[model samples]
Target: MVAVLVIMTAGALLGYFLRKQPKIVMINDKLIMLAVFGLLFLMGVAIGSNPTIIQKLPVLGAQALLIAVVGIAGSVVAGSVVYYFFFHKKY
Candidate 1:
């Protein structure tokens, strides 16, 4: 919840600034790449240090991939529904 608030505040600030300079957008691929790489590094460290985790990897890996795919799909659908209800009408 706190993280959501912080992101909302940051997004608001970025939007406000962007209005003043329509040519400039705050979010870009580089930021996304940085975040993705950072998360991957952390996940790698966690997986590397846990012997039990590694041992169970063969069984868990497929399950994890399926869960991740489902979660991503659900999130995308939810986001689209929320945006359609909240913002699409305005545009």
Candidate 2:
């Protein structure tokens, strides 16, 4: 955890110093996307190689879907409440 935070802080400081360089910014964006896709592909491969997960895929899919739906519903309800209270203007 400390190492992760230290690396992240170092990266943030580097990025701050490099903020004026558009070329570096563009390269950084591409690198970030490549890293994300690589991690996702590796994760899929790991999950695919697990037989237990394969067997429970259907149930896991249903649970994931339920959790996602509930999360979205809760976010929408909470956001609406906040907007109504703080940002909405009466006619």
Q: Which is the leading candidate under lDDT?
A: 2
Model 2 reaches what TM-score against the true structure? 0.83
Which portions of model 2 miss their true places by more than 4 Å?
A: 87-91
| Prediction 1 TM-score vs. true | 0.48
Q: What is the TM-score of each candidate against the true structure?
A: 0.48, 0.83
| Model 1 steric clash pairs | none
| Residue 46 local lDDT, model 1 | 91
Once superposed on the true structure, which residue ranges of model 1 sit more than 4 Å away at CA? Answer: 19-27, 62-91
Summarize candidate 1's per-residue lDDT along 1-91 as a digit string, tens digits: 9999999999888777677663455444467688999999999999999999999998899998999999999999999999999889673
